[model samples]
Target: MPNSTTDTYLIGDMKNGKPFNGFFIYPRTNIWLIFDFYLNGKRLFQVYNDLLTASMVEDTETSFTAISNKNIFVNDRLKSGIEVTPVRVKKGIVDIARNVNNFRTTGFILTLFDNRSPEYIEIRPIAHGYELISTDKNTIEVTYHASGKKLVFRDLEGRVLTKSKRFNSDHYSITLEKLAYTLKYRLVDAESLERFVKEQW
Candidate 1:
């Protein structure tokens, strides 16, 4: 098995010659897993909140499915103009293309790959509803809306990084230095409150 790591990639419309820097996490093979994508150093998808995952299927042509968790927070705020595309990377001697299509509510497909099975695949989400508020060497802030409520996320110190709105949701996230923290609304509203900690990037 290949050890999981974030691999840097240069991806975009090859014809344009303006490929942006991106990265994806490939922790394992044969199973769809979360892929983190970025463009010009800005994370394009909230893979941690969206729970994005994908896997390649064996067939005459390359095929795969990328899915996001079906949760109210995501469903309520999903951008109507979502766009997806397969990214081809140059790995040594072979040039592999991970063709993707059939985009739907919570997932998409990697239709094929240049007539060969790809050892790995990378997918990119063109637009997500959230907007970047600010960033510094130590912290980053982002904002989005859900259930008619505004959400503001900041790095450590629990500061109101953005002036967009007041903290409305019981759910929120924060990252400071090396520590990641989140308050899941679903878990908080559940019958039993369970303490769960998850790593985010």
Candidate 2:
């Protein structure tokens, strides 16, 4: 399999007999399918929360064959299809995370696709020594503070998932039906903050 570098694949026709064409990330246990498109010369990616059940159809040294049983949502309706023989199979997020060299010391944002809804979650990192804000809106903000070196996962309406005084990466592995995430971070020199933003944002 290839690395996390963006690759192209074919999304077959829908089960309802509708023709479809798109690109997606390689199938993995947990991954995002970002459809790329151009509008007025501006590139954009449409992220979808999709589940795949893949079975090998053929195998070759250069490329392999597989069919994916895809479950996705379109137009507020659940759609399913069996994609036969995708063009290529590349690596995904989970694969990149397994390779430690990809780790960034500075904080970063993780964009997640919610399986149950069209809404997605944006996990943002707050700088140290800042006052956390509170809002009663539907959008939630999960904050990590340096005071007690604790990480607080909560919704804007005030629902807590895991709050630990001690920083632990495993705390985020727990599945919360409304909001689920896997947090990973590394401590870096405070001076590198600017560079981090440029690289991530």
Global lDDT scores for all candidate models: 0.29, 0.29
Q: What is the C-alpha RMSD of each candidate to the true structure, in Å?
A: 19.3, 16.0
51, model 1: CA deviation in Å? 9.2
The local lDDT score (0 to 100) that residue 41 gets in candidate 2 is 30
Ten contiguous residues with the weakest lDDT in model 1: 189-198
Best candidate according to TM-score: 2
Please list the residue runs of candidate 2 whose C-alpha ends up more than 4 Å from where it truly belongs after superposition.
1-120, 129-148, 153-156, 159-173, 176-184, 187-201
Q: How does each model score on TM-score?
A: 0.19, 0.23
Residue 31, model 1, lDDT: 31
lDDT of 1 by residue, 1-201 (tens): 122322334333222453234544533222333344446654454232121123322322223333443211233343432233323323211211222223334222222222433222122222232222112212222222365324444533556555323253212212221121232222221111111112221
